[model samples]
Target: MKRFFAKKEITAILFIGILFTLSFFNWRSAYATMKEHTVSYLASAGNKWENLSSFIMDVDNTIHEQVYQKYYYIEGYGYIQELLGKKEINNFEVVKAKDGTLHYTYFTSGPNQVTSLVERMERLKKAATKVGSEVIYVMTPDKYVTGVTEFDKGIPYNYANETADNFLQELEKKEIDTIDFRKLMKEEKEFAPDSFYVSDHHWKVETAFWAFTKFVEVLEDNYGLVFPNKGEYTNLENYNQIVYEDSYIGSMGRKEGKLYSKVEDFTFIYPKFETNFYYYAQNGSRDVKAEGRFEQSLAFTSLLSGKGNIYDATNDKYFTYMNGNPGFVEVNNFNEPDAPKVLFIKDSLMVPVASFFALGCSKVYMIDPRYYSGNIEEVIDEYQFDYIFVSYTPQNLTEEFFPFYKE
Candidate 1:
């Protein structure tokens, strides 16, 4: 009789606890989504009568998205992964390397098809030639470094390097001048594990600066061009290094959270020398213009201004370069009148790379095809750039990047 009474009492306490927890979540989700839900509900009122089940699902999804403390919930999931000793997170969408770096990857056995992609590049070449500008396919290195990065058993490899090799070979056959940073980085003894962030897919700003130095070398040797301040532009010591520890949670970090992977430190590198720049960017109706000094003009330092422990999704610190790949952005270096005028059709990897132009370029225009609403060919003709660089990482060898040249 005594044991039966104790069991009943324990069951009653657990039941009440579960009910209270459910009620708390229900109230939060309701309060959080009340306005949006009401608007959406009215928008779908007619559809609700026609396809009642479908309308019900829309409500369900809205509720699902509005879970209170969503970030904490994902963090809890990351903690669970740590407790389980799982190297792969969210079913292999992200994998942890031996060094604890997060990588975006999917299962692949061999190289990806790039014949059509090469054709797109060939078209880009034609466009550049039509505008009297020389073009080069600048291949940015993927985050997954060969030999240096390793995954545990059962972790899926993305085979991005092999894909890159095939794509470059195709470009070479077409006589397309190319710069493969993967090969360049491999040859550099200093391009070791430390050159990358531990928890982000993007390379460090220092690495991007190193790339800028090498790119200048290419121009001087191949294009018969000489930089005005060659010594000042290439040297890393001339740049101001601002570092904030425990400051960043990268794209992958936001997915896996701090428990599965540690929060990464962010570093900002800018010219220590006095300089003047005029920058303008446009994305839809959002237009931003900055002038006077590199730090104030080119760099969007507002993203780094954090209000405490909580990270805002809108403020992705990595995009502090040129305000994060707007549809169109132009930079005019008031100091470098004789500097080469260059244009870049590039991805996010080239955002920081374009900023390096502030050191010497007279004019620089960048267009991200994914966002730009203007015609690429028109931009090329009007600008008449001295050099046009079409740069994309190996992983981005897809229909998305080659959207410029379509029948």
Candidate 2:
């Protein structure tokens, strides 16, 4: 008994010593990440002190994320904040909502400058309309839903909702068709809390499915791309809902850590009906071409393998949809060959939700302006689709997304 106790004490001491040494290495990596953040900040939107501060918080989050022992470091930091009742982390770069959701926000001096962005949309409309392709601006819900999500005093408000309102209004004036999903979110008040993940900025997969139904409704009512199985398409009962509880930590959750925010439940939803697709996706550097069923070819099930212990921040389960924002993506729905061909030029919010188009449209093509290497006008001219859609989250309403036909 005496020898066993002696060995146990030695093991504990050595383990503690190793952890102490690891802390130095973590900080060293953190400092290097800070330098990268500095360069990235200078290059983009980090023009003001407010932007700089939030961007630095991003650096802090990324540094710890890259460390050898990042999970423990994040756990410790989260615990400290939990004990101190810190509703705001990183000097309000990330704040906990009254409902416990994490948000990336900062104090807004005024509404964002979207006049030029609207002009860019107008130009794209002219080009698309010239080629006989219609343009529709689809607005995804902002994380900070107005009149629903509340934050503690001294927390920052980014006014992204206001900016979205401004942007959509301008598009309407330009006679560009627009879909405001915020209205739908508000109408369904009971599900507002459940609509978005408390730990991340993106909507839940189930919510994305619901949004897709809405997209089909618009296409049917306005553009005449109606589906006979539209009712079956929106029916959640016909889908396989696999709930991976306590497994997700989203982009925002990574920054704040688990203790500061609860682990999210990823409800992976897909159709129970038969489907076939020929999918081709390219992110400029790499390309994937496959032909199979929905789960086989369209979705990346490899991301879902890590049940409850997903730590690599980049291994985000949310990325399971279309394997993340590929620069260019084509889904030929052999199941719906006679259906309309749709196109989306937008952001990551649509990246997952657009998968539902397989059930409705005959063929779907998506371009994430931030990634696609091909010419937008050339693609538009070459393919005269039934409809063309443009969606950018309010927070992402910047010059980078409106990359087509900008004057």
Candidate 3:
């Protein structure tokens, strides 16, 4: 009888404990706190769980005075990887060079899916011919090809270079007017040693501007078009160049942390003159007008401002160029309304370049096909562009295809 009573008492205590624990969790999740009222109400169950987990992890993190999630990563997977002497973290492979530079793994594969691309371009070219608009293709090289020459053995398989070369040749055979920027970057690298970042994949501001100059040169030569004098670009005094020291910790640095890799410098280039422009975002039912800037537009500037945290998405120095890519952005330059209207169908690599064109041209219609959901032929019909430039970095080419007919 005594043993039976003891067992019942123990079972009752355990049940009460579980109930208390569950009650506390329910209260914590449903608490009408500021964060809950503002943000948590909109969160999905998965995000709520993540927030709960983050809160629990923050206890130890607070004790150590570290970022909430960094404590767990550093003390958990990082510890295990160090113990095993491994350099790769997830899909990113961290490589160290003799000069203490960091490089990530790169692979080159066969050509991109160009069947849809060719068909779409042909159709667009046909429509463009009705309006007397010409299509131009520009290829931007990968960082592995333009910047880092030294790498760990068997890393960054040299397939991208071959694929880009082959694609350029194919475009030529098809009689498509293409600009192989690899040749331009190779020549620019001779003078601008820091044309590409050691830690990041994007080119430096100097290199981007150089390519823009080359773009004009090609346009003038091939299309018999007049261009601005080279002195406007050749002189650094024409533009304002701001250098933010140690402000960049590229995508590679973010993965491995500052202890493992070196940070890079970022430069912001803006036009010195006061410019007048109008920006329009035409996303299906969302036709909105945005005031333009040499950098980010006025409407979305505050949303993208500030010195973001090391890992924060908006804090990236590259965004100062044109506030990154929006689906469909149109710009009208009041500075020169009579200048030729150009349509740029490109990747994010053309962000800064696109801004430059917007500054010079009377009208510029920028389309990023990857994110765009509108009819391309209709846009060409509406704009009646003088030139259509197709620009993509080598690595991005494989990922983006032209969606010509389908929105």
Candidate 4:
């Protein structure tokens, strides 16, 4: 019995050894094939591995902070494999001409971007003027340009201010009407330390109010439209509530590679007016309820909503603005007939600013070129706007504006 047991043990050991040797050779060849496939797949997918890898790394860090380090590393390896196998491109930054102004040796695409935007403005202006509508370019300030407290000194490039200056000069040369909000803010010293949110890129609602006031002034001066003073407009500060209190990770914070820090809590402010309001985007027209007062929607809620068909009937609500497609958005105000029909060509930075226009304009048609593939000229012709405003952040201005213009 002992001899039989010994023979069985030796046989088992030999079988296990042979299996290990076969697996070793197989793994090497398999690993080589995997490497080749990964490279080929990445090349076919336009080499988006960097962005995919970064996103995976972020997810890993988030999970790592929650649990074990080994889980994070293992998940990261899986993410790498998935990324290499992907057939589609995810996130990408738009490229622009490198020859432009330099701020602290960090050059910006200010010249090309501004020039191209001005040219688009010229086309838009001619189209609007042909329809007997006025064109007003509303240039919004970036957090860095506006000198928001948290971003006062950290920005590597003074590109925001440079872009603003170049844009203004180019517009002036073309005799285009513009609303320079940055200069107005600077002249008024609106950059009170806490005026901007600590973590987010957007200014506090108070800043928007101030901007609205300036916008009102522009309307009065340029179009001879008179808006009532602050006393006449309802202030909803008392009704303002904190809808969400958790720390937010904003675009800038993510781009700056500082995800660990807590972002400021975003507060949603509503006017003391009634909440009975409805809105819809359809057939190139935005229609709203005629009777009820406009209730301001939560800022963050809008961000949570993703993109879809703009003409769908399901989008006929104020909250729909938050999640609707980024292309052309038409919002109608049923309050007054004489209210201006505005064409707001802007970036994501203009989302919060749309609220101010809601109060002023009878209808606001917003178009984001990043998502819109159709001819911008045709959209302008179809909308028949009374006023046109172009607003964007410095980063987008430097990167995206040129491509849209070139197209």
Candidate 5:
């Protein structure tokens, strides 16, 4: 009994000593291993809980589907991530502009955002006047503002409408040349119900044609340049239908992750004009050929729908134009001699509209603030364009416009 007791005591002491030695020497590794084990255990438990919950939810969903309608969790875990994920990482990229203003990568900031934007427009006007170029501020409407989708309900403010109205008011007060597309859109509300695509942020090709008519009208009225009216142009109908119908998801829908109803099938049509174009990227400082042919089957087919650095040659083949870099793009008309050079500062909203301007200008220079970080004043001076147009969506106006202004 004594020997057994002594052995038991010895074993306890040995075990304790071994544990202490391990704690002293391998503490970090042991902690790490323990942490990993705990995480794995928690993750396994979470997954099991999720499976069980999903099984139960599926039963309820099945019953709901049978009786009432579809089962949707408007505020679900996936949706939470979708909503918060973007906001968490929504830090703007800031670059120094030649003017005192800080060029934010995505949108605008600072106190009195509207006034700052007006001031910026004034600066652009002064710069344009200095360079002897006409500045036409083309305000593009936002998809959400047009009331196509209800997802924009959660936005903190009605910045789109407010900023647009304020900017227009300020521009008119200063007698700066501008185009209020919002007013035009309101007047042409007959097609608003079906004018835009539910799944995509862009207006349909038909809408583009409508907007193009208005844009051309503005150009002719303001600048004495006559673009052929719609009656004069050859219209090609039924180019293509939505091939993959419901599979398409827009930037907003993707961000929301709520799985709203799919976009409806619609026909895309374009003018039957021979297109020859080149797109210059401000980032790489290189010029490449752009696609002259229009594809009826692809999504966003009207905009030479290629991704990442594509330039289309004068023929039917599509090529990477400017390597997906944002900034200014210059398109030249090789057919016309001593043609007027026009500079367009635009957002993604202008992509489809480029085709319309391409026919009007001898050289159309487009600058996207999302890309291109060079000196805007320098570019304007160097190009010496006769007409300077700034086209932007309301979303972009609230976000990207003021950053380009001189404080």
Candidate 6:
């Protein structure tokens, strides 16, 4: 009985000692994560709880990162999916067509959200009208709605397409000037099968160029702005495509890993003509400039324009057009220094399309509403923009884009 008691005492002592050692080593690290630092542990009850909560969250984040939970958890389940030929991941759902195309299921905004967006646009239109600037909303369609679904079994419903169409209908009732690319892309997809990338959500360089020409045509029809040689400007022979074979794994590919969505082509489109332009870019407080050649407007200009292999990550290819995201990009057409100016408010979907506007206009000021903090009315007044373009892909059609004016 004495021996048993002695054993119990020893076990308790050892357990407490080990815990103390661990706490001693980990306390400093855990303390570093506390958002609030109080000299006394007995501060207020609320303060102590808040600090404790912050520490717990930090510790949880550290554990998940250390274990690589995203990769391991998703990849482990992904491996099982591979064996069973499944298409669903935790937050990711991919539809694999027989033609080796992958379509990602996107969540669409509800009616309340859509109504809020329409109201915001109405406010923006009124503001632009006050400054005498014509507001044109450009809607880039989603990949799922591009009509390339011959092999697609249609397992997952496309919220993005349905919501986009609904939103566009509301905009039309308001009689707002709009450019819908869904119809243009659909008509062209029948002839050119590679309008959109196979594994990615973005449109191909060729597809973007076609869309840009359509944009130019609209400017001519609506604003009476003419590119002296519009036909020659839109001609395919004037541009060069840098196509890398089997070199990209897109956003959806990254989610599913290599097994499901394999590597595909990365085609970079740039002008082979006399490319002379001054490009100014700003991201937050940092301002960057590049001049001579249209390549300057692109992100990783050196790499995509011929410094590195196109076979890097899919983001490298997509970002090659205008980098990931910039607060603003100003393009000046040296050829037409006195031409009309346009203020383009866009998401990454319009990255490739900006250069097209630059070609037709004297100056194109590309502003990303996601990051820009200045007043749109002030921008319209200051820049004296003739046209204001608010562009976004259907997937990105949400209230967040217009949050600046929202209540």
Model-by-model lDDT, in order?
Answer: 0.83, 0.83, 0.65, 0.53, 0.53, 0.70
Candidate 1: Cα lDDT at 229 = 93
Please estimate how well model 2 matches the true structure, expressed as its whole-model Cα lDDT.
Answer: 0.83
Stretches of candidate 3 exceeding 4 Å from the true structure: 1-87, 92-116, 146-148, 156-158, 190-193, 228-230, 282-306, 405-407
lDDT of 2 at 80: 95
Order the candidate numbers by TM-score, best to worst: 1, 2, 6, 3, 4, 5
Q: How would the candidate models be sorted by lDDT, starting from the highest?
A: 1, 2, 6, 3, 5, 4
Candidate 2 per-residue C-alpha lDDT over 48-113 given as tens digits, one digit per residue, 9 for 90 to 100 = 776777786888787746686667877888889989998887777888888888888888887799
**TM-score per model over all chains:** 0.86, 0.83, 0.74, 0.61, 0.60, 0.76
Candidates 2 and 4 compared: the better one by lDDT is: 2
Which residue pairs clash within candidate 2? Answer: none
For model 2, the run of ten residues with the poorest summed lDDT:
306-315
Question: lDDT value for candidate 1?
Answer: 0.83
Q: Candidate 6: lDDT of 186?
A: 59
Off by over 4 Å in 4: 1-113, 145-155, 226-231, 234-246, 254-259, 275-277, 281-321, 402-407
lDDT of 4 at 254: 31
* Candidate 5 lDDT: 0.53
- Residues 1-407, candidate 3, lDDT per residue (tens digit)? 99999999999999999889865654554444434434643464556655666665544343333333552453466456546655555654655454444555545454455545555566677788888898878887666544445554655454566667766776767777888887876665532325666556677766777677777777777787565444564355788786767767666566655555556777777667667778876654467576655544512434233455755545666655545666788888776788888888887667777777565687788787766887778888877888888787765555355666431
Q: Candidate 5: where is the Cα deviation over 4 Å?
A: 1-112, 145-157, 190-193, 228-244, 256-258, 261-271, 282-288, 291-325, 403-407
lDDT of 4 by residue, 237-352 (tens): 53444444543433322322122223345455555643323343332334322234454332224442324222122321223233333565555555544666777777755665
Badly placed stretches (over 4 Å) of model 6 are: 1-80, 93-99, 106-113, 146-155, 190-193, 297-299, 305-315
Better of 1 and 2 by TM-score: 1
lDDT of 4 at 200: 44
Whole-model lDDT, model 6: 0.70
Model 1 lDDT per residue over 60-157, tens place: 77676566677788899999998998888878999988988888899888778998999988987887798789888999988887888899999998
